[model samples]
Target: MMNALESSSTRPYLIRALYEWCTDNALTPYIAVLVDDTVQVPREYVQNGEIVLNISFDATSGLKLGNEFVEFKARFGGVPRDIMVPMDRVLAIYARENGQGMAFPMPVPAASDEQDDAAASPDESQTAEAPAGEPAARGGMQLVPTDEADAEEPTDPPPPPPRKRPALKRIK
Candidate 1:
């Protein structure tokens, strides 16, 4: 038997909940992920070690929000491809329209010394310290909050948007 922490992580459950929330509201769900060797995605679509995917029901087929990974098949540039993203690699899940979403702090992966030396690189150590949503010296840039508004935005905006939106409340 395994302990609760060892058996499951809260990340996947949150992902599933957010996904369901998006679908329930008829919102297009998008997920930003860090691309690595374990990820299976179209290399051409990836930008700067990251990829944002449209995981809406219309875009993905056989979408499985599993505990370990999110597996789905979607088309990229008209070619269907299977995309696999580890739950740990998911940085955020947001609605494409208004950008209401939750950003997850990147989990530090355990260091492994016994792995093949051929795959090891000097830069591997740098990533372990750089949490998601922050920039690293190695030049990997994560999304950081900025106060500057969009340049093209209306100087005098319309009335304020509505408040009191539906949100998931965890019991524990």
Candidate 2:
């Protein structure tokens, strides 16, 4: 028998489900990961200690969505790069088209790790885990649902002309 904390994590399963959902709906699956020494990704591509990966069938080769890690080979700057993301480092998995998917809680660092970093940065160690149903912040990034007005717009506008009316407006 295992205690609640000892049970296997559900993050991998959710990832697989969302990946399948994205594919079935013709959406591109993307995963946001918190980069650390343990994570293997292109250092140049990481920004603000985070990297968003496209996990779609078109983007990756030999992709393995495993219980412990998300392993894949992807091309960056036209060069092939092997990527490995530990399950704990995954921040969110969603579709690029509509941003429909799930956000996961950040992993709490082990007591030993906390002790090692305490001398270097005391403030980070003091942050508590999020409540049962809320997503936690990691590497100074927190994902919270926000309205369109609150979301930041891209600096470069699309080249196409703006539509006079919304495309397929939903009436409630």
Candidate 3:
């Protein structure tokens, strides 16, 4: 549990907390984002790979803030569009009225050469075989390499399994 907590990024938690704070005070919540190839937003609205968005309840619908991404539907120039932003791309979340909020460091991805060591060789036999979407296992799980072509590819994560409540029973 401790390891999980430490490994977990605090960006999502802080974003949710600040959003709630803004709404409680009747202030508009805004987010500043660094738009990368993975970000799904209106290209016209983005300038210099950065965009500021109004994320208040009135501005968005079906807002789902998750550990890996923030998903929502919002209107842009009278047209509704879906927006998906990776947690790492979020630079700051603040109240538009007072500009009071927190900013986080954007984690940089590792170099391609370092990440694609397993697939660098053209010879198929020389490369280790692993099923699609499954990470290579050495002694433990290893991170999978990502390609530039997959930058904007959306992932459909499986729903978490339901949990059963514990029950006490008498045993001989």
Model 2 C-alpha RMSD vs. true structure (Å) is 13.4
Show pairs that collide, candidate 3. Answer: none
Candidate 1, residue 51: how far the Cα is off, in Å = 0.4
Worst 10 residues of 3 by lDDT: 163-172
Q: Give the winner by lDDT: 1 or 2.
A: 2
User: lDDT at 61 for candidate 3?
Assistant: 99
Of 1 and 3, the candidate ranking higher by TM-score? 1
Instruction: Kindly list the per-residue Cα lDDT of model 2 for residues 77-171, writing each as its tens digit.
Output: 99999999999999889888887788887677886776788767776656556545544654445546899886888788779986683222111
How far does residue 126 in candidate 1 sit from its true spot (Å)?
Answer: 9.0
Off by over 4 Å in 1: 1-7, 113-172
Clashes of 1: 0
Backbone clashes in model 1, listed as residue pairs: none
- The candidate that achieves the highest lDDT relative to the unseen native structure: 2
- After best superposition, candidate 3 residue 68: deviation in angstroms? 1.1
